[model samples]
Target: MSDIFRYIQKYQNRSLKELPFTHVDALIFAQLSYIDYRTIRNIYAKPKLKQIAHLLDLQEVEAGYLSGKDNRRLLLALAHAKRYQNIQLINETKIINEETCEQFHALTFAYKQMYYIVFEGTDTSILGWKEDLHMLVYPVVPAQQDGVRYLEQMLKHPFKKAIVVGHSKGGSIATYASLHVNKKVQRKIKAIYNFDGPALQSVESLEPIQNRYYKFVTQATFFGLFFENEENYRIVKSNERWLLQHNLYTWMIEDTNFIYLDQLDSRFYQINRKARDALLSLTHQERETFIVSLSEIFDDNQITDVAQLTNSWSQTSIMLLRSLTKVEKEKRDAIMKTVGLVVSEMLRR
Candidate 1:
């Protein structure tokens, strides 16, 4: 299965004007926003992609190390590539809140006289995951609010056209920002690419610019199908299994485009629909209480990332079971049922 890494190798010599920017490029920029720009703070401010790549190379050589699995490496390679070398990064911002469980990052780039606003997805922090849960009931999350402000600020700069793109939670914010921006800003937006991002709880405000939205999801997408999405979406092929398909890196690409699927697998579609219905069945207060309780339980175990919890599955499972015993009976049952359905669906797959 060919991924963005291969896409870069294939089209590295071609500029955006030569081959045109596709969804694959959007995903790359979205993922690139995850890199800790603080490391290369000096040049990273309004630096060209080539300059960012140079800084990354220096960091690798100085440390005498590089992780092949690192997204930064992929981004650096893309930066050095002829296709993206001239892309100019204008601004970047990150806001993190542990108490509110909010994490947001946005990067503005200039390519071929147009602007691209990319949002970073969920990170390893527990707060980042909680923000995803907050979407279940909240009409607009803190991160989404930040995204809108960031876009508005970016529009203050000189630009002829604009595009918004993101993956996972970031994708949700990208859609939110594009829809909520003022009419003057909206006039400049050419497109909004959402890579496996959850849908908004309410999209009435988005109706005006609905035609500008493009959604892409995978076969076994769980997060992408979380809420109501009235717009049509392209289901793309993925190399990973089940929920791992949510990883943008796992999505397959051909040349400059994604390997699009006509539709999701039947079983996976049924499962996703069932999961969405079940989640919507819960009241807002119930969903909030459940997420808070679940987050507290994870905090009690000092588990910051999903990998950490999985690494000590036996211990974490025991801890989770014990913690559930203390919850109020009504809330506990709802939480347990939702969890059981997810586990059963995974096992069935």
Candidate 2:
């Protein structure tokens, strides 16, 4: 199965006017938000796609600082590809609130008659991951607040319509921003594309823009099923398994569209539901304590990335055990039991 790179090569010569923007195009831009665009050009000023290509060609040291593995190289190629070069970057902002452990990036682009707002997903930082967990108990996150402000600012510009798009945590923010924007701005929205992003903890605030939402997740989805999803969602086939399927690069594309699946894998759904239920079973204070403890453990070990935290399994296991000793027995037991259930379910699969 093909991915976005192959899709670009196949349709690189076609313009958005000729083919029109599709969900696949949204996914490409959503993933592109992960690139460190600030290093290439001033994000405050409009920069042509070719200008970004030039920076990448020069191997600018900061071009792809947050991009993993070959993603930077691929994004560089995409910038130069005929299909994307005509797209003009309007604005991009990356904000990190250390106190709240929130990290967000909003990128606005002008393509043809439409304006696209893309939100960046979690990077390698432990703080980023902590914020993702914080979503479990909080209805609104700092990043979501930034998203609303970004969208409201962008809507002030002259444009026919807007499309909000994001992958992973960015997807959640995109949906939140669309829902919270003023009704006048809401009327101007074309659609919201959430690719493998978590659902909102509460949909009560989403009524105004409910119909405009479109969610896409892989058959083995985990993050996408995190909360409640009242809006329509599609299940797509993936070339990866389990959590790795969360990566947009692993999502399958055929020609110009995704390889849609009729339903999500049963095991994935079972695990997701049980995980959500288990978390919800805890009190707000309990959840907060658990998340704080987990964060502290990572800090104690000086682990800033998930890979580093997981790589030294023996060390991590020892650290976790020691951390648990410091917590109240009731909270510790609840955390352990929930973890046991989740692990058992995964092992069964």
Candidate 3:
């Protein structure tokens, strides 16, 4: 399946004014937010995308969180693409607090008198999953609140229009900030694109900007289904299987757009619906305990990477089963049942 890499090669010469910006472009910037540009020389200069390619060390990228299969190509592609050469990265805010287990990254890119604020998805590190779990259970996570604050700060910059986009947990924060920002500021926002992010609340809660809110999910989405999402989302075809579809890099691309699909596979839909129900049944305290248990399990297993856990979910499931053995007998049954459903989902893959 043709994906973003091929899309970049095909459209490297086209300018934003020529073709117009699309969600696909936003998605690229969203994922690029993960790169640690601080590692690049003279980062304080805030170089354009073209300068970035020459300065970036791919060997460093190959060792970092973006090290997923075929993922390292993104920066090189963006650097060489004439369409993005003039795009200027203005500001980047990244916060990682071990005490709160908060991992947040936001990026501001200016192109043709517009600002694109991208709240990044979690890194593939173990703490990334911890933050995702925090979003799932907490009414509002610290990182999400930070995203809102970051957006507000970026708005102070001189820009005629602003667009917000994010994937995974970052997507959740982009929408959250859109809703929280004052109406005066809201009027400045051109659009908000959420890619497979879990919901903080129903879309109806933010009805004022509903028209501009666009949500996208993959055919076999797993993370996107974690929480309640009342808003309808467009589905994109993916080359990966089941939960692996959470990675937007696997999503198919056509020309300048994502390969859209009409509906999700019913099986993935039903299974994740069941999983969400089971998770919601847990009390906040229960959820907290479960998260703590997960941390212990990971530490015990010497698992430092979230991708390692996901890529070997079946083994992770077995580890979870062992972790839950000490839960109160009353909570055990419910939590165990939830674990069973997760394992079953992985087995189905």
Off by over 4 Å in 2: 57-67, 317-349
Candidates ranked, most accurate by TM-score first = 3, 2, 1
lDDT of each: 0.77, 0.79, 0.79
Give the clashing pairs for model 1. none
Question: Which digits, one per residue and each the tens of the lDDT, describe model 1 over residues 135-215?
Answer: 887888899988888888888766568899998888889988888888888888899988888888775656667788888
**What is the per-residue lDDT of model 3 for residues 1-349, given as tens digits with 9 covering 90 to 100?**
5888888898889888798988788888777877777766355467788877678777776677564334467877787889988788888778888779888888888887799889888887788788888765777888878877887777865556899999888888998899888666788899998899887744348687788998888887877756655546789999987878887788898877888998888877877776676667767777787788888888888887877877876687777667666556666666567667766766776
| 1-349: candidate 2 lDDT, tens digit per residue | 6987888888988878788888889988887787777765543377777566665444543444454554655656667777788687878898988789998988988876788889999988888989998998788999998998888888876656899999999999999889888877888888999998988887665667768788998997888887765547899888877777888888899988999999789876876776677667767876777678878888776788877865655565566556566556765565566556555554455
Q: How many clashing pairs in candidate 2?
A: 0
**Native RMSD of candidate 1 (Å):** 3.4
Candidate 2: the clashing residue pairs are none
Identify the runs in model 3 with alpha carbons over 4 angstroms from their true place. 41-44, 65-69, 201-204, 296-303, 307-315, 322-349
